[model samples]
Target: MSNSPQKYKTEINFSNDWDISTQDKYIFQFFHQQLEDLEANQLHVHGVKLYKVESSIVVTAILRHSLPKKLLLEQVVLLVKNKDGKELAKKQFDMALFGELEPCTARPWKFLFEEADLLVPLDEIENEMDFEMAFEYYEKVISDFELYLDENWSNGLTVDQQGYVKNLVSSLEPIKVNEISIVGFHFEESEQAVNIFIIIRNAFSQALTIENLPIQLFDATGDIVCKLGFPIGEFQIASKQARPISLSFSKEVFQKENPDFSSWKIEMVPQTL
Candidate 1:
């Protein structure tokens, strides 16, 4: 759903994190309530502030629910742009993953836009906060049956191959947010390395950067066939979305037994204590 906010006339607050003198409680207020003879279900945004930092701009805004009941959306995309219509950042949020938003209730939210996500330098930003915030709501409910693929993971898959994976996930159990699971998607053996394509599911609410994460491969009988530590960057699985990732190991690790991993079952392993 697109955002058709009825913008208010208040001046937006623009201040550095250390400078609070010029800051106001709210820079802009958006009223998306149902008007006369019209229907409106948009999520209202109010009391916004842009706090700029060295590497990121933190957006502090209030999110209000206008739906009849408590709204829990798992997929919502927010786009931020400058006054001149230059794009700043666009980020997706899992509303249900974070918490429930009650009807007509207002809550504060913060969106961090890193330097990599910004399209232009920070200096060009308007002091009066002359930018716009737009929200896009998606109806697709994320559940245990879905696997959101990282760009790197889906780049190599054919359209048919992707569809097969989607179908394959229906029979698999849901991976919880606190659990880290590495299930085999596909694998190939070579003279030097065995590249194992994996579907990594992480339900954690926040993204984490790590060095080595354990990946366990087990046979149908629940016996671990092999265990390996793979170096991973950031593992961020959306609320109910699993992601496909690839891990490669030296062929020597599997020299003892050549196993057909397609029929193997994946077991959940805790990320930490």
Candidate 2:
């Protein structure tokens, strides 16, 4: 009954608009219009180096918009919270946007996490872990922007530049405690049950004074065993500050609820400066 030749429809894949090199040229102008139309993009947490002992999240990313020329961005707001969504803390960081005329030229943003503002509770510091890095790009016009990864960046800075900035960063005052130690003890009555000792240090050169640090303890099954701390060592953690702190708890508590204490986390709240 059909006289016409058989026909087929073609499918097409769309690429991210922002990810392309040519897109950068016009991204700025687009951003300008966005500022007028949309609400300020709030990226919760700029740089987070938190541990799993505490339930926390970090928000960080590059917020950009393009048009014909001129790029514009404002500081992004980073927020952290507990599992219940109770706001733990927040930080605001300057937005960095890069535009390139060519594809492979040098266009790197040096990200320096404000070391001093991390306000994680002392109890959460008992576990071993690292901070989570999450970000949201608003007015996401281009598609491929997420693919832009810089393997060359280390500790939030370029490799070579990171090396050069090492001394400069070290010369700066104590930002926050960069390390934690956990010692273990075995009970003679129960060979399988071991009591863990914990010590958190603020090894910075300058003073890192903070208030209301929330430290929560988790069992092997990722349940909140105990949320400790209201009186977080209220003192100035001077640069190169290394001091011993304590956590008093029982292995039986963690062993009874969850045998998997091996996978624990501790997240500290970063301060807003």
- Candidate 2 residue-wise lDDT, 226-250, digit = tens: 5544354563344443322334444
What would the per-residue lDDT of candidate 1 be over residues 119-232, giving only the tens digit for each residue? 777776644386677775544332463578767658878899988888876656665545555678676767776677777655555544445667666554556666677767
| lDDT assessment of candidate 2 | 0.36
By summed lDDT, which 10 consecutive residues of candidate 2 come out lowest? 140-149
In model 1, which residue pairs have backbone atoms overlapping below 3 Å? Answer: 177-203
Every candidate's lDDT: 0.59, 0.36
Q: Give all TM-scores, in the order shown.
A: 0.39, 0.26
The positional error of residue 175 in candidate 2, measured at the CA in angstroms, is: 11
- The deviation in Å at residue 25 for candidate 2 is 12
Give RMSD to native, each candidate.
16.2, 21.8
Per lDDT, the best of the predicted structures is 1
Top model number, TM-score: 1
Worst 10 contiguous positions by lDDT, candidate 1: 29-38
**TM-score for predicted model 2 compared with the true structure:** 0.26
